[model samples]
Target: MSWITQKLPDVLFIQEGPGIRKYEYEENGYPMINVRCVQDGYIDMSSARCASMELATTKWKHFQVDEGDILYTISGTIGRSAIVKEADLPLLMNTSVVRFKSLTPDLDPKFVYYYFKTDLFIDELLGHSTGTAIKNVGPSHLKKMDISYPSLEEQKRIVAILDQAFTHIDKARALTEQNLRNVRELFESYLQQVFSLIGDRYVEEALDDACELITCGVAATPKYVDESEGVPFLSAQNVKSGKVVLDKYRHISKDLHAKLTKKNMPKKGDILYSRVGAGFGEAAVVEHEFEFSVYVSLTLIQPIEAKLDSYYLKYLLNSPQIKSLARSSITSSGVPNLNVKSVRKFLITYPALQKQKSVVRSIELMESEIGNLESIYQNKLLELDTLKKSLLQKAFSGELTKNMGEAAA
Candidate 1:
């Protein structure tokens, strides 16, 4: 606390959002930046709304956004901030954001923006924010926040060092993201090739012929009485492509589960296929022993023990070909949906049981390799992010400038 008082003593001018209405925006007028515009140290003006220049000036003159001013988000998603650029000029702040202009000329706006991105600043802001459902921190709270103050030249040097470091870091991240995409596309392409390669010995059979049971999940959903106190309930969101996501799961009472289970109780080896909504056609085999109920949007498939392998069927259902077919089979409706009958009609080109095992083995190897690589990439990304935060901390603590001077000498 003494460190903050000693370092930061200048006045800070903070302005809340204009709280403009939808009717105030115009097709051909001045730009209006919202919380979405401020991200990753830059203001993206492409999606900003245009408002009547005359009306904005008359009503929201105080909220006028200028180049070099810091655009900060104060509500909904707090702590995200960006420095306003020349391209983002001639704009106004919406209700969800606030503008901060440093009254102290010694402080660099970019330095202040970078400081706001630090963990200390964010934690402080979050601590002061008040709300039960949605947290919010007003200008009064922001004004009380403290920050390190250095010489103007020292601040600029630190900013330059950070700017250079981040440029390289961002470039590496972009390449990693592209590589991840390429790896996924390669896997999908190989998947299609594997399925397409069928010999004369292979036979075409309806999906229903290979499955002992194909049925929809529970029709009635239990209300969210208490999230932590009930049995796990699976939905379309919980069922991913080739995987079952258990996080963010809803719950139902024991009585409701008993009632819902009357339709069907999910068991180990049962394939949970998404029949409606996003991720339609994706499937995952339930490999756990825990009891859980699923929503109606997911179709439960129990493959014949002798006729089909559950793991093989899971990969097949998640393939691009089957996903496309499922989308095409949907009845002309407002939302995409696949019924049990249509799903049953999907053709399955199956090989002998032994050959099926060989194919599954091959695909599993590729999936495992991809999963490992993804884990490495994700860890590296996290490391890079951590390094960035560490650099920010050092820059504000005066160690960054001190180290740079020693290296130069």
Candidate 2:
């Protein structure tokens, strides 16, 4: 009962603007921050902007969010929070926005920041949210908010523990992220080394001499009755993020698949590259067993696995140089297209089958290590996030005090 009203310091609602909902704006409306600017877990100033600067002096002057302010989205994308990094820039507070600033020296700002990130606070915020489609929360709701923390020393201790813990976790995660990037760069570099073009210094060999075959799919608008009756129409859309996203996979009738060119069904090992639309030339190997009903806008590039490795070649096609060259060859303005003929012109070095296998083996090894590091840190971060949530729950509910002496020490 006593904890319910601990007489904690005041936490104000984000500063509200003078303008009401659906209000008409003048030439320079209030310069409120955009919702999109406050991205998940961070503030993206890249797209952050003010509504307009013109407002009455009394309203306009106080709207500016200062440095060291903690901002949270009180409207759209509820619970999205981040600390304002750029203190110099004067950004008008957006609607349903709130800030927590001017903390006493006894309180730790980092503790305050972490405290706001807990499920307890989120539940408290969510409990107050009103409206079905779009939850609207304003100043009155924030002033009534409550949170509990230990004494100043405990607060500093909690922040210190979190700081050391997150620092270690973050360093590991950062290294893994960097390693993945390095592997990608290494693969790209290998591609360039294979296909060097200079002032008539490098040899330009025909792609056919290097690759086994380049096959094009059929132009068929396959019919779709039901997922129970038809096979999935594997289009370029399925080739997303370097893998097939089967959730939105389309289906085509059996009759349509029969009428469509036999080449429409790509066999395993064939590299499928999107040949039409905005995502042209993005390729992925057909690794899974699926009925492929492809469009003519797509092409299949394959190499005799004995003579050339498809993964290595797929890496080559995705390289920046090759992609730029392919983009330049597109003729249609409305829908950019790259045919099999144009793809045959793609230059690459044919470093004997043995060396090709060696390159593949080396990349595979590095990729495996990078994958492990990424998975490890990814799992660790998830655990830390969950721990943060659990700790926040305990801290607010009084359970956090059991270990308070040890943690504080």
Candidate 3:
């Protein structure tokens, strides 16, 4: 087998999109391909913005994206590539996404696109990239990068093998993803069933009447200190997956914590509810008796031990119905907020304390089972990804065709 190596620009033409201003976007027109549109292997135009024909023909006349062009994201979330098809026509490129075309007939675009999937290519691309937080690579950087390929015929053969292999791998991946979704849905469905199908022994009460206290945390920002010298501070971000995660928490001076906790101290069994921003409606139970001061973004709920189970209330708040009600009541004037008044007015349905404990146990058991299944499926997905990279490595290393020839012999 013979292979040729050259700089990317020597065999491919690379161009990125012009910066389209906010005012230029219209209700409907040519699909403007942004960085988001380029998925792993194909372009998804569902969320694409539009530019008018006037802009496409005038200022952006030469920026039209054609079929057979390979699109690569050159900015944040770099290294994703896709091939444009007929259905993706009349498309125009937006900033940060670059299109590549085969400058020579000897090179296959699909071959180069597949190479973009390899770790070798990604490592090289990142080596040429710049920036600390958000990495970026330009067409000039891509122009200087090297690409190695066999003859066009061999390239097509390798591409054919990859396409067939990936088709099966992708299908398996889709099914595994669906299974993961189903497991999560099962938990959610059971929660809905448990909450909705209440027995005659159950009673409904307002949250204000059920809990001893329903108040938010400190409003004023506190002075910061080193982790070893200060008290742990909890915020909405600390509450996730139905538990308080202190792994990435910040620290406040002990005096500030003392002042803050006087008004709002989180204790074991207290439920921390996210009140604003993206994490709103998420609730978690404080399982440990750790000293922590909460941020204003978190609402602390102290359930009356005799009346309500803290775990039960935590699960109830996270239920789909309660979440829906919370969404409806959220004040979106600024950040989406779940005010104390709104939370107090929420309806709480429960059975006897014994029954509540039983329900909690059942839900916890089911959650554990679902978590195990999720781990299995997640591992399967990782294995599939590894398999793909393995196949790409073999194909490019010439071992794939060599193995095929030996099998034929």
Candidate 4:
């Protein structure tokens, strides 16, 4: 910035967006582009609202966007920017957004647009942003944002390099994301197939037939336990589909935990199923020996002697079939729920205990394979993101062009 500002033709002017009101918005009028319309380096106007012509001409006529102008979000989702195109002209903006127009021909707007995507600009914006909950930046804060550039031709060269790199990176990312989704869907389809019986060996029975007891968790809310003097308290949030997330834990005193679970202690090989709200039917096998007390939002299932394996019950509870059954039995109107009766009466089709174990083993193997692939793709995505940041740093520090020059030599 020190070097680039030294050769400036004119100080950059920053303008605030028009303070358009909700009343000024209409179903059909002059198109008004807000922050939502600015996405992925382009303006998406398919869902953009409109303002009455009278309001646009009378109050916001001066705020109309033109080709080459840069629109930046200043509140809520801060620092996202997009360069205006010819088709984007004559659109009005609200106060949540701002516009930046170069006063000199020396600076290339396209190059500047890429700069905003860099960590340098984002760090600066965060430093100047004000607000406890929702951060904001006004024109004054934007004016202080430091931006450096090389000659126009050099800027164009950098933009060209980044553009090519981004295209390749984006394509790889999309493919990886799709592959991840495919693996998940494959697991789901396999689950449905395994549960869908083909032979007479398997018989359909109520969920109660396979379990000794299906009971709800503690009805009374336990007193809040201090971190040092309490045991982990499990709730619906801790039980995810086919897994238990113990990351964010709340604790209750050992005395309270004792009284809460005096009826039945949740132990290893037990299946814990969420019975209420958004996580209804999601279940996890108790793999850990750690002491924990569950809330009323969860149900503790005690499998009968040799009828069901805990792992099989966990997977069955997570299957689409079980979820559909649970939905059908939801007696509450306001909040979704799978009550004790629903759990006891829920239908299940199963074969011998050995067959259930075989299915469980197969599912675990598939889960492990999918998990490995997911990790690989996730790590690759992280690497690509890091690569982008590195490229931006090199481009700004002249290292990119220096390497290009050396290659030419």
Best by lDDT: 3
TM-score of 1: 0.86
Clash totals for all models, in order?
A: 0, 7, 0, 0
Who wins the TM-score comparison? 3
State every prediction's TM-score relative to the real structure.
Answer: 0.86, 0.64, 0.91, 0.75
Where in model 4 is the C-alpha error above 4 Å? 1-3, 6-38, 42-79, 84-99, 129-140, 208-226, 229-237, 250-267, 270-281, 291-306, 323-345, 402-409
lDDT-best of 2 and 3: 3
Candidate 2 residue 206 Cα shift, in angstroms, is: 5.6
In candidate 4, which residue pairs clash? none
Give me candidate 2's TM-score against the actual structure.
Answer: 0.64
lDDT of 4 by residue, 1-409 (tens): 2237432124455777776678888887889888788876788888788988888888778877788888888888887889889877778877778887887777888888888788878888889999988988888777766778888888888888887777777888799889888878888787887788535798688988888768887778777879899988988998875788888768999998888778788888888888889778888988898888888898988887478888887888777788788888888898887888878988887778888888899989988998898889889889878877888787788777645533322
> Over the stretch 198-282, how does candidate 1's per-residue lDDT look in tens digits?
4678868899998888988777765854766788888888886588888777888878888877767789999999888756888
Across 118-201, the per-residue lDDT of candidate 3 in tens digits comes to 899988889999999899999988888899999899999888888877888899999999999999999889889888876889
How does candidate 3 fare on TM-score? Answer: 0.91
Model 1: which ten-residue window has the lowest total lDDT?
1-10
Q: lDDT by residue for model 2 over 1-409, one digit each (tens)?
A: 2232332236333465445344434445544566666664567666544454445335467767776777777786677777776743566666666777744565566777777777777778778899987987876776677767666777776666655555655566577567656756665675566445323333347666665668666675655678898866666776764455566666777887776645435667778888888998787777877675676767777776766677766655776777887898787888888877888877765566666566667656755765676676567667656665666565555565535524532
Clashing pairs in 1: none
User: Where does candidate 2 stray beyond 4 Å?
Assistant: 5-11, 14-32, 39-42, 55-63, 74-78, 85-88, 95-112, 123-172, 183-226, 234-263, 274-282, 294-309, 319-345, 351-366, 380-394, 397-409
